[model samples]
Target: MNKDKVICPCRKLTKGDILKAVEQGASSYKEVKKATKAGSACGKCKKQIKKVTKKALKK
Candidate 1:
């Protein structure tokens, strides 16, 4: 994923932000949401957030 790509436009968060959150121990969707507030807005980004989170987990 592109680190510069914005995943959650609602919170202006990028994939890198979510990845950092994952590295910080956010393994679940809810945890990533709580940590980065990625999908807390319109909810459209939840799926992408999960994908990014899973990708980060693989690393």
Candidate 2:
């Protein structure tokens, strides 16, 4: 995935941000949301956020 790609437009968060959050110990969507504020607004990105989070944690 493109690290620079904005996965969450509401927070302007990129895939790298989510990966970084996971690397920093965010093991779930909830934690990622709290850590990076990625899917906390509007909620449209929640599904994508969960997908990213799950994929990151799998690695």
Best-fitting candidate, scored by lDDT = 2
Report the lDDT tens digits of candidate 1 across residue range 1-59.
57989999999999889989998999989999998888998999999999998878887
Highest TM-score scorer: 2
**Over 4 Å off, model 2:** none
For residue 45, give model 1's deviation from the true position in Å: 0.3
* Candidate 2 lDDT by residue in tens digits, 1-59: 79999999989999999999999999999999999988888999999989988998888
The candidate 2 region of ten consecutive residues with least summed lDDT is 37-46
Write down the lDDT of every candidate, Cα atoms only.
0.91, 0.92
Candidate 2 local lDDT, residue 50: 93
TM-score for each of the candidates: 0.93, 0.95
Error of 1 at 25 (Å): 0.7
Positional deviation of residue 22's Cα in model 1 after best superposition, in angstroms = 0.4
